[model samples]
Each structure stands twice: as structure tokens, then as C-alpha cells.
Target: MTYKQEQLSEEKVFKDPVHRYVHVRDRVIWDLIATPEFQRLRRIKQLGTTNLTFHGAEHSRFNHSLGVYEIVRRIISVFEDRPHWNKEERLLCLCAALLHDLGHGPFSHSFEKVFKLDHEIFTQKIITGDTEINRVLEKVEKGFSQKVADVIAKTYQDKLVVSLISSQIDADRMDYLIRDAYFTGVSYGHFDMERIMRVMRPMEDQVVIKSTGMHAVEDYIMSRYQMYWQVYFHPVTRSAEVILSKILHRAKDLFEADDFTFKLEPTHFLSFFRGDVRLEEYLKLDESIVYYYFQAWQDEDDVILKDLCERFMNRRLFKYVEFNPNLQMKDWMELYTLFQQADINPEYYLVVDSSSDLPYDFYRPGEEEERLPIHLLMPDRSLKELSRHSDIVEAISGKKRTDHKLYFPKDRIEALTDQSLKKKIITILYGQGEVEDVR
Candidate 1:
């Protein structure tokens, strides 16, 4: 048999907390997993700074990736005998599922935001670039690496294949929801994943759920909604993220400043700071490497960089208050000026973070980021959008909810010797004797 057709003599199983057991029988998958690029995921935290808030959320992308592969494995098993399900695409789907998150850097989203990088673009690069992952994929077949890259890029010719990985209710989402919930020790991310998988039907261009499984799909949607608010977007987690982003910003600014010299060279981040990160440099960075820099930078000459690093390393996170940009613009401006006058750098210390989510949405073409609506297969084999059939989904569908928080160093403000300035900032943040403990 060709390498592409090779199977393991005995299936390799990973005992997983979320999926019970992740079974791997394909030799190609085994080889891919052994690749250094894939193994690097072991060091990258799945939830970034969320560990600060939910102490148990220390799982790695490696765990989540395997769960996704297992979920897709079970899903393809059901599709094996179904119409419109291409057997040739089975390995492709599995490979994509396993390697979908390959390019996530340390503290994934924060790094992306500060560096102007997209993990998806890096994912395609890793699959197609000069790398062991590409070599493994190339061994599958000529041009197979590009096929995997295309699947991940959502540009593959087979829309059905793309949907299996990138659609509204794909294996990636299913795994992360439950897997994140399991690690975070939260009840919000649980749902009948087995039921959803069993009811999943392959179609010409996408996967659909049977009418009988509408409730299961609804549960899944609501679980995602709750997970976002209860755990994923927890205020404490956001606070850590804010500090992390500020650290990156400070380091980058210092790098660009001619007078600033680091106590220790930020070797791993130089490429990111310079905006010319190559694949090898990108892969070499993990949470440990980042933490090492954050620790070392605590002793740096740059006070802002040193302070931010210390705060991140020691969990001296900034406190946040509900902020409305529109109604409180004048107040925000006044606070920004007061922070500067009080010897605090407003650029690094005062930040407004906004998080928004649409739990569910029907298709609306021509929108900036169009979400392909979930569809339920009717008893008569016709298709209906999810919200159309489920009232629970309809009520929340198409409704976008946004939250805005103004984050500042409460400790620093409280420490100020200038009594009048401190009182003004406090009054603005907490109206009239409402200065309760934020933590």
C-alpha cells in the first residue's frame, strides 16, 4: 500500500478528558502528530490568559486539536455510508481537523492583535511552506499539502469538505466548546455532542441536522452562548488579556525606540516586533518562551515595559468598570488627561476593551463577516434554517450583544499622593460613594 493508504497495526489512543478516547489508526496522522510543528502545540495554552480567571483552564492546543480530530472521526464514520459523503475526502477531513489550529502562537489572540497576524494565514503557510508538516502531507499525494491548506483556508473546491471543518457547527467548535468547558470547570459548554453527530447528514455543499436533533443543536448553540459570557469572556480573563496585549505593545515600542536597550534581547519576539516573522521563528515561540521574556523584562530599564511585565507575571491585573463610549466620551477624555497628569502613561495604562457575540444568525449576504446559518433537515427531507424551526434559537438569532469595559490600574490610582486627582478619577469611575471593591 502507498503511504497515503497505510494504517497502523494497532490504533493509537489518547485518553482524553473531553472525548473519553481519541483513536488514531491512520499512519499518516500518526506521522503528522510526531512532527515538531504539531508537537509545539503542547506548549501553547488553548485559552491564553484565561488560566488567571479559571485556574483549571491550563489545557493546551494539543488537547483541543486531538479532540477535534476525534469528533470529526466519529462524524465521518457516520458519513461513510451516507449519500453525498465522499469516501475519498475522509482522510482530508481528518487531517484538516487535526491540524486546523497549527499556526496559533503563544497567547494566541493577543499576539495576533498586536502583530497584525492571522493564525489562519499562518496555518496555510505551515501546511504549504518548507516544513515537516508539509512533507507529511506531500507524502499523502502530489499537491495534497495544498489541498489541506485550501480546506483550512475555506477555499477548497469541495464545499462539503470545507463545511465539515469551517461551518457554523463544525468539529472545531464542538471540540473547543466542550474541551474548554471541561478544563475551565464550567458547566456552560456541555451539550449532547453525540446526538448532534448522529443526526448530522452530509449534503451537496454542507452538513445538516435532522429535525429530531433540533433540540440538541439548540442546546449546543445555547451552550456556546453561555460559555462565551460565563467563561470565555469572563472579566478577569479579559483583564489578563489586556495586560498581555499592553506588554506586547510596550516591548514593540521599546524595540522601535532608538534609546531603549533591553536588559536581555527579546530574540524570539524580534521578528514579531519587526513585522517580518518567518515560520521557524514563529514556531519556536510558546508560552514558556513568552513567560521567560515577561519574567526577564521585569528587570528592564524601561519602566512601562518593566511594570507591565511585572503586573502580568505577578497577576496584578487592571480593574475594569462598565464604560459606554458614546455617553461617556467627555468623562473618558477627562480621565485620560488625569492619568497623564498623575504620571501614568494613558496609552499603556488606560484601555477600553470591547467584546461582542452573536449566539446565532441566519444567513445575511453582503455583510462584513457572513455566518452560514445552521440548517435542519425536515421530516420530508427539505431544509429549514435553524432559527426558523426553533423558537429558543429564533429569539436570540441575529441579535448582536456587545460589552465595553474601561480597564485601569486601580492600585496605581489609589496609591497616588494627589488626593484631589485620585478622588476625581474614583468619582468618575464609581459614581458617588459607589467605590466598591472591583475584584
Candidate 2:
């Protein structure tokens, strides 16, 4: 089948909070979103368990997909009549943006960790395989679906289209940074997006902000830096993630041992436990279904399963404290023993959480996962690498920062019937003082 862009009789608009209105002019994009595969995003929260910490973060990836499409639409508007910006690439870029996250399942991060599934691969399949998305893409032209897939895969021959959706600073990142910040009510992600869009110019191989707009680029980099530390890497979110991961591990262990009796048998999880997940089964799983199981599993006889479900649903997040990996191995071992003595399963109750990110990186030749360093197009038509010209960017480039925490249930330990064991655990975990709130 060939792919052709078909216009809808009446253009549809999604009332978006960030972009105001996400307009869909093409029928293909509309049908793609309406497909059950894409609609599943409505059930998958954009920030995962971050909603546990930030109640307002209840927005879904469905919101983000629209936001990214709107951003790309704006960028494409800028690219019109510009050098190296091919107008023909418009539909391809839009398709890639809309379908980029079609593969993500419910509670994406935790599911990915437990099942070892890569959303990217599933995304490719949805676009190129036998599905409504593929059928829509094939309507454009033969091989058009592949072209869109190529853009998403970052292998499209057109560098401009590839860069528009998947660069150091692309539409996806631009949307999520601002959208996540808005929903999470964090100030760190407020950047001049309009200014960035105005300055963006299509280059031979990438997009570059004009020299005069260097300040806007600096602001964007800084916004990302602050957002990472302040929101994306928040410890409370990680604590929930740690608990979620342990729940899956313990459930899988119990299923294998045949010691667990689930009110609702783990049908959806069987393939994952066997290390083989069909796309259909994967697509059927969403946050609502998971929450339904969590509700049911709260009554399971297995202590760990029941406890974890209650913890996740009620937002009884694990308490965390600063940990230094190099110096804390012995302490971690001791904590594990203390957890055993306290009758808390060390495997499910004790966890180490670490998060690291580079705010920005300078071009280092031949580095794997090398980001296309931002450039400023000067008045004289010369290109300059961003860090060379921006003092703030230069100050932060290549600096990777990491945070680590040791997580446990503080309330449970505090309520233990065995006073002696509780005291020993508390002393070993926090060293004579009550555990401080981790926020």
C-alpha cells in the first residue's frame, strides 16, 4: 500500500492547555490518534508515579503527544521558505511526532523495567506493521510509512526532518519539559518557548538558534537543568518507582513458586513472567487495568503483594535518605540485615535509588550517545558551537550530577511491636535521630 496525505472534511482541534489548540488538518493523523493503540496513552500517565508526589501531574501521554505535534507544527511553520527546510517533509515529521510514543504501556517505566520491553521497538511495529496507523500511512504513498518510521528511528536521510523530532533540543523534549513542569506545578521548566521557536533556523544537518537569540537558548538549557534536579529527578517519584519495581519482582517470584493465590489470576502478567510479551497483550495493558489489579491485589494473602498494592494506591511512599554509593556498601549490607531482623523482606523493602543527568554537553569527538551540540548562526553566516559563546552553557556543559538514596518504610519500623528490634533498626538506619522527611 502507498501512503498519501488526506485532509479531513473538517479539521479537528484538541483543546490543549500548553499549546492552546492542537489542530489536526490531516485525516491520517486523526485516525492514528483515534486508533485504540494511540488511545491507550489516555490511560498511561505522562509522569508515571510522579503523580503520587505531585497530585496535579495526572495528565497523560495523550496530552504530551498532542503537545509535541503542536510544537512540531509551529516549528514547521518556521521552516517554511527557509534554506534546507524541505516543505515535503512536513507530514513525515508530524507523523513521527504523533506516533513516537505509541508503544508505551501502562506505568511505562515500571513495566519496561519488569518486562524488559523497549517502547521504541513497539512504536516501529505499530507504524510499519498491519494496523490502522500503518494503513493510514500507506494511504499517503508506497514506503511512506517506512519514511515516517525512519524519522522516528533517527535514520531518515533528511537531516532536517530527523533533527526536528529527535535532536539535542527537539519538539518532544521541548513539549515535555514545559508540559510536565506546568502539570507538576514546578517553576523550573518555564522558558521562553516562543523565543526559541522564533530563533530556530533549519541548518544543513540540524536546527540552530540565531546569535541574537543565544540568551533564549541559555534560558532553555537552564530550564532543563533546573527541571531535572527539581522535578524529573525528585526523590519521592523514585521512591514510588522503587516500590513498584519490587512489587513486580515479588509477584513474579511468587508466581514461579506457585505459592500465590490471586483473586484475579495474573493473566496479563504471564507473558511478562515468561519473558515473552505479544504486542496485543502489551497494548491491552494500561494504567487503569493495572490500578484495577492493584485494587484487587491489596487483598491477596501474600504479605508483600498486599502491602505493596496498598502502598502504591495510597501513596505511602518509601522514606529516603542521602546515600553515597562508594562509602555506603557496608552500611547497606548492615541495613539489609537489620531489615531481616525487623521481619521486613530486604529484597522488597530495601532499595537504593540513583539518578544522574548531564544538563548539557560539549561536542566530544567520537563519543557514543553524543548529542548534537547547539549552535548559533552569526550575522556573518558563521556557525558557532553554543558553549564557546554562552558563559552559562559553558559553565554547565559535560557536568554530570548524580543523587542516591536508601529507601525503606519508616512508619512500619516506627510501629513495630518489638521495641528492641525497632530501636536497633532505627539506630542502624538513621543513627540515633528520628528519620527526617525526605522532601
Q: Report clash pairs, candidate 1.
A: none
User: lDDT values of the candidates?
Assistant: 0.92, 0.85
**Model 2 per-residue lDDT tens digits across residues 1-439:** 2234467779899898888899988877887888877888899999888887888999999899988988998889988998888888888888899888888887787779787888888888888887877887887888988998888888889887888888778898899999999999988898899989998999888998899999988988899999888887888889889988888887788888855567789888888888888777877788888888888888888888999989988888888777887987887898788789878988888888889999898778888887888889999999999999988999999999998888899888888999888877777677623454744
Candidate 2 regions exceeding 4 Å error are 1-5, 432-434
lDDT of 1 by residue, 12-118 (tens): 99999888899999999999999999999999999999998888999999999999899999999999888999999999999999999999999999889999999
Candidate with the greatest TM-score versus the true structure? 1
- Estimate candidate 1's RMSD in Å: 1.2
